[model samples]
Target: GGVALVIDGKALGHVLEQGMHHAIVRLGSVCSSVVCCRSTPVQKQQVVKTMKEALPIRTLAIGDGANDVAMIQEAHVGFGVMGNEGMQAVMSSDFVIGQFRFLKRALLLHGRWNYLRTGL
Candidate 1:
């Protein structure tokens, strides 16, 4: 169990490369804390790119708006929340899902299958 941290955008510098990577790395060191409440679309993508670079993370970005498109594309697995905000997120996503509830089984089954296939 972990807490989610809504990283304050004010804490980030105008040049977010270094700052964003540090933030995501710190967040990843903890167990279940998610980055949230971000106000910028760029921030969403920044977190994913940072984590992907600093860790062996296979990220799943879920979104429902045009703002989420870049973030979804930045992730290893992009799940779109269909009909929530717009179709843009879904159009750019790897998969479109109707409900958030299904993510658990999707991840579980996908993880299991990948493990068997790759032995990772």
Candidate 2:
């Protein structure tokens, strides 16, 4: 069984100071998901960048506001939600969607088809 961790901005700094592999392994061993709350833009970006650098798997960041722009841009695949938040995220993202629910179709259908076609 795994846990869900809720880490605030200050805690994120300490987590990142450890080596990437150690951090990933330690986190994976205990938690299935880690939600960072009240994190700064740089902290958000660091999380994405750390995952991208430490793991072989693709990393996707989803956001809808200007505050998320850095994190979205740092991810391998950035998904932007078009909403009242603003357009900065949309401008920086690799893919843009009208609503958050459409993310299901984008990732499961179109994403899978593209993966099959490209053989990536």
Candidate 3:
């Protein structure tokens, strides 16, 4: 529910590229890359697979709609926003967020605590 900003693809892509460039300059390496305007489920899966092939680490996918189900399923960690208009996505997700901001805390703090508690 706290989500905001719906920008056109061209503008969103430009902003994402700029952010990636800034991160590269500030971090002295590329921390992430931006792929713009992937308009299909299969395309999204391919993007995820490509990134995984490029990097030797796990990937996470988070989304809130039916269009994102495939990508979510492809990732090591998948989260879906619930209590919104996202029934299908929630059903397919590894974790469902009833409260959106709780997701950040869950991944950043609580999730770590849980891992430590479980010794996993």
- Best candidate per TM-score, number? 2
Candidate 3 stretches with Cα past 4 Å from truth are: 1-29, 32-38
| Angstrom error at residue 57, model 2 | 2.2
The lDDT for every candidate, in the order shown, is 0.76, 0.81, 0.64
Task: Rate residue 70 of model 3 by lDDT.
Answer: 92
Best by lDDT: 2
Query: Candidate 2 has which clashing residue pairs, if any?
Result: none
TM-score of predicted structure 3: 0.65
Model 3 Cα lDDT, one tens digit per residue, 1-120: 232223335554454456543422233224443332544666556555555665666777777789888988988888888765658888898998886777889798988898899995
In the range 80-107, model 1's lDDT, one tens digit per residue, is 9887587999899998778878777777
Tens digits of lDDT, candidate 2, 1-120: 778767788777776665454674467446665566788888888887766676665678888899999999888899999999989999999999999999999999999999899995
Model 2 ranges off by over 4 Å: 1-6, 17-21, 28-34
RMSD to native, candidate 2: 3.1
